[model samples]
Target: SSAITKSTKIVLNLESLGSLPADEAGPLARYASTIQAQRHDYNGKVLSIRTEDLKSLAIIYDMSPDELTTRLIEWGVLSPGADGSIYTDED
Candidate 1:
């Protein structure tokens, strides 16, 4: 959760969605969708992910840290050494 960086806090108005479905087949899947939706004005763009942040993402997704990091790099969620540049797949 902490992987989201301090910047996400600035963009998103984080508050409880109120009564989310925790009994869903996959807790994280539901939570992920709801969490991603929590972002105000988000448009399928990259997030703030430093190298140290990968571990948190991996734990959230239940994947190896490196795999999630690699996928993010592939999906352009993260670019090494870039400063606050947001990218989308269509770009």
Candidate 2:
């Protein structure tokens, strides 16, 4: 028998956040910061994010909403979508 452990993989292109438009990048970053690595529970991630945190993170990291989307889809982290959104199915 084989052990099948489960964990989620998230990729944020922390380089292009500045290069892209806020309207576009903002939402994605809003989505990314929700995946914070924490110091409490086994995985202290939240189910959602806030608008302010996304803005702050974008100002600090090199994340780009456009590039991040393509890469995440390629890496199988996100599912490309309509309505200008990407998705992850983590359990």
Candidate 3:
């Protein structure tokens, strides 16, 4: 017998809880609660998403890459590097 697993990384922000629609928000709220109990400083920690998912997720969310980037940046999950590159605090 064999087991297979599939998973992907996703970035989140403080506003994520409120911004997400109800269906999506529920799971995220649960995950946040789990983390909050495990780490006192979890609220300040940065969760970096894989760069590869950016464009794909943007499309899935019906947004252009630029729009997604802007939203992420505004949410404080993504940052613009001094060298004109995009990065996350965890990066």
Tens-place lDDT per residue, model 3, 8-59, is: 2345564544566656445445555555666654645454445555665666
Q: What is candidate 3's local distance difference test score?
A: 0.53
TM-score of each: 0.32, 0.33, 0.46
Q: By the lDDT metric, which is better: model 1 or model 2? A: 2
lDDT tens digits, residue span 1-77, model 1: 33334342211111221232444224433444555667553443323224444455568767785555445444333
Clashing pairs in 2: 13-63, 14-62, 14-63, 15-62, 15-63, 16-62, 16-63, 16-64, 17-63, 17-64
Best by TM-score: 3
Which portions of model 3 miss their true places by more than 4 Å? 1-44
lDDT of 2 by residue, 1-91 (tens): 2111121223233444334566655655454544543422223322333334434444454654344336446644445444445444343
- Each candidate's lDDT (Cα)? 0.40, 0.42, 0.53
Ten residues in a row with the worst lDDT in model 1? Answer: 9-18
* Better model by lDDT: candidate 1 vs candidate 3: 3
Name the top lDDT candidate: 3
Model 1, 79: alpha-carbon shift in Å?
2.1
Off by over 4 Å in 2: 1-63
Candidate 2 clashes: the total is 10
